[model samples]
Target: MILIINCGSSSLKYQLYTPDLAQVVASGMIAKIGEPEGYIDHFVGHRGEHHRCPVPNHRAAFALMMEYLQSPEYHVIECPRAITAIGHRAVHGGSVFFGSVLVDDAVMKALHECASYAPLHNPCNIIGIEEAQRMFPGTPNVVVFDTAFHQTIPARAHMYALPYELTQEHGIRRYGFHGTSCRYVSQRAADLLNRPIESLSMVVCHLGNGVTMDAVKGGQSIDTSIGFGTFGGVPMGTRAGDFDPAIIFHLVKDRGMSLEEVEEICYKKSGLLGLSGLSNDMREVSEAAAKGNARCQLAVDVFVYHIRKTIGAYAAAMGGLDALVFTAGIGENSAEIRAKVCEGLGFLGVEIDPRANEIARKGHPNISAISARAATLVVPTDEEKMIAIDTVQLTMAQPGAASVQMGHAPSTHGVAAS
Candidate 1:
């Protein structure tokens, strides 16, 4: 079996798959760690069980996960030895890891050094790996980085216009995120179209809470919306994306506001929340807009405008667009937003069937109109399956490794739309 672990600051989400990645054996989550009361929700097949307890930390959570997987009540696995390999979702690998890697002493050292890049996430990921090493001894652990797929971006796109010496000294350059999602969605789009990924020039819009627009050309990322930081992409739930830096200087220097306060406003008090003066969720904003709320309408318009603008820019960058992929929360579910984004892209030969768009989540994911030149697809991303695939491939390359049959595409059994 291959186990995939994704650790947040106070929670862990895990999935277990057979070595071949054809089926998901089990999946669950441990939430509210380090709190007085924590929750564990585990599932085997269609049945689920929930528990409430005082889970002190991630270590305790992992122990409970093991118990649930091996106990007579739910014997998803016989023992720790049943797991052939482990895969972890690491948020930021900085510039050190260009792709998924098998864990080792040197890799651990580098992971620690890169912790400065994502102080809120990488440390938790490191802890998860360390605990897995102690609990599942001798089992190879593979790390699939969220930023790895964008490492193919060239220097011209990744570099900032700042001073060469300053940027080089500080390692300040664009490292686009949501790479794992883009990689999966891009490949899945090709599969759905029955075409080779190498012949496709596509733009993948990952419009979740944290948004990223990736320009994938010939199976490699040429450029992306996100820059040196996560908040530099399209405006997200609470992030103020692509804002003027001069505003920051004016706030701190002229308005006498502290840098910390300005930073908080930029990261936590902006985006849909700031623009709509309501909920950060797109569903709620759309509802309010439908009810004739001016601010909410403005928020929706701004969001759609940015998405459409980015698509046009990427099409120009790639010479022409062959496919436009929509994945993640808002991208997959919101038909209105999809229509609005494609409304102005007629020049690019982009068109969508309204009936197909409405039924996208009902198993008809391709919404492109018959007259359109570019294909538009709503491909649900499977990051965990991607991680599991990487784990199986890396572990199977080892000497004396057991051979396992592999599947051609990722299974969508346990994955939800978001």
Candidate 2:
């Protein structure tokens, strides 16, 4: 089995998949880690077990996860050795790692150096990798980066307008986020359209709590919405996107506010939450808007406006649009948001069938109108599966990896199991 681990700041989600990637054998989540009371929800087949206990850290979380996976009540695996390989979802690889690679001493050191790029995330991801290494002993682990798919972004689009020397020295460039989700959805869109991915130009809108608008042309990311940071794209649940740097100057220099205070406001106290003064969830904002709340209406308008504008800009960048794909929470479930985003996009040969858009969540992938020139699709992204595919490919291609294919541990040349 292949184990996929996604470690967030305060949560760890995992899925156990077969080597063939055909089915998920087990899955669970350890939430609110490092808190006074943490929650564990584990599922094997259709049976689920939940617990609320004191979880101090990621190591403790990993211990509990293994315990639950092997418990008699839900024995998904006989032992740790049952897991043939492990795949990790790493948020930021920076420029150090352009693709998923086996973890080694040098990779660990590079991950430490790249921690500053994603302070809250990379440390936790590193911890998960460490715990897996220690617990699963000789199992090979592969890391799939969220930023790796965007490494193809050209210099013209990724470079900022700052001084060339200073920017180069500081490693300041657009390293897009949500690459994993975009990659999965874009390729899924091509499959749904029955076309070759290398011949199609599409824009993938990953609209979740963290949003990303990526222009994928000829199976490569030409440009993306997120830049140097995760909050540079379209407005997200709590993130202020594409704001003027002058606002920071005004708050810090003129109003005498600390940079930390301004940063908090930009990252935590802004976006739909700040604008609506209600909640960060789009469902709540849309509910309020329907009830005639002016601020909620404004919030919805701003969010949709930014999405529409970015779609237009990406279409221009790709020269033409063959498909527009939407995925993630908001993109997949909210029909109202999808309609509003497509309302002003008719000029780009984009149109959605109203009934199809409404029922998209019911497994209708394509919502494009019969008369539309470009296809609009709602693809449910499976990032864990994507990571698993990469893990299987890379691990099997390593030297002396035939042992792994036969459900045995890998050799030293393929992975350092010691």
Candidate 3:
């Protein structure tokens, strides 16, 4: 068994997969963490069980999940060590660790060093690493970075036109996020197009609570919208996204605001929520907009406008666009946003079949019109599976590697056999 874990600030999502990563034996999510009554939804096959219990912290949550997994009803594994490895999703690798790496004290130190870059995410990720190591001692664990895939971005595109020594000395450069998702979906798009990945030029819009767009050429990320941090892309649920550098100065000098206060506003109180003076959720914003809320409608327009403009820019950057893909939360579910974004993009030969887009929220392969020049698709990103695959491959490459065998270890092959 290979268990994949993705940890957010207050949530943990997990799935147990067969050694080959072919079948998901069990899956569950722990949400609303640190609450008095956190919720858990567990699944096996088509059956599910929901429970609301006190999960004050990630440690408690992981313990409860372990208890459930070890119980008879959910004992898909005969023993703990039968599970070969635990693959964790580490958010920011920066320049220190380019790709997925096996977890160790040194690796953990590196993650801590890079924590300053992703303050909102890396701490929680590190928590998952600590708890998983404590719970599954000696079990090989891997860190699949969200920034690793974007390392392919060339210097000319990634560098700012600022002082040469500043960026070099401070390590200040465009290190893109959502690289993992970009990698999975772009390749998936290539597969769907029935073309070689290196031959496809595509743009991927990862719209979610955090939004990012990538210009992927030859199966590698050449340019991406979000840079240096998650707040560099399109206006997301809470983030203000790519704003003018002068705004901070204006706020500080003229508006009598501190830099910290400005940061707080741009990162948390802006974007859809700040613009609409309403909820950050698109569903709610769309509803309010439909009911003639001008601010909410404006918020929607702003969101759509940025995406449309970016698609044009990135398509130009990649020379020409062959495929356009949407993934992540809002991308996978929002038909209205997708349609609105493609409105003025018809000049780029983009066309959407209204009915196809409406029914394609669950990662449907094609939402473009039959006669459209370029392909439009929604590929639900499988970062967990990617994590699992990398874990299996990297661990197997280590010399003298062995699975931690339990007393009741089955004869069946583990993830390494894959």
lDDT of each: 0.88, 0.88, 0.84
Cα misplacement distance, residue 400 of candidate 1 (Å): 14
Model 1 per-residue lDDT tens digits across residues 200-317:
9999999987899999999999899988777887888889899889999999999999999998988888889889999789999999999999999999999999999999999998
> What is the Cα-based lDDT of residue 164 in candidate 3?
61
Worst 10 residues of 3 by lDDT: 405-414
Residue 236 deviation, candidate 1, in Å? 0.4
* Models ranked on TM-score: 2, 1, 3
Candidate 2 local lDDT, 300-386, one digit each (tens): 999999999999999999899999999999999999999999997888889999999999999899999999999999999999999
- The true-versus-predicted C-alpha distance at residue 69 of model 1, in Å, is 1.2
Candidate 2 — number of clashing residue pairs?
0
TM-score of each: 0.94, 0.95, 0.92
Weakest lDDT window of 10 consecutive positions for candidate 2: 406-415
lDDT of 1 at 195: 98
Ranking by lDDT: 2, 1, 3
- In candidate 2, which residue pairs get closer than 3 Å at backbone N, Cα or C atoms, i.e. clash? none
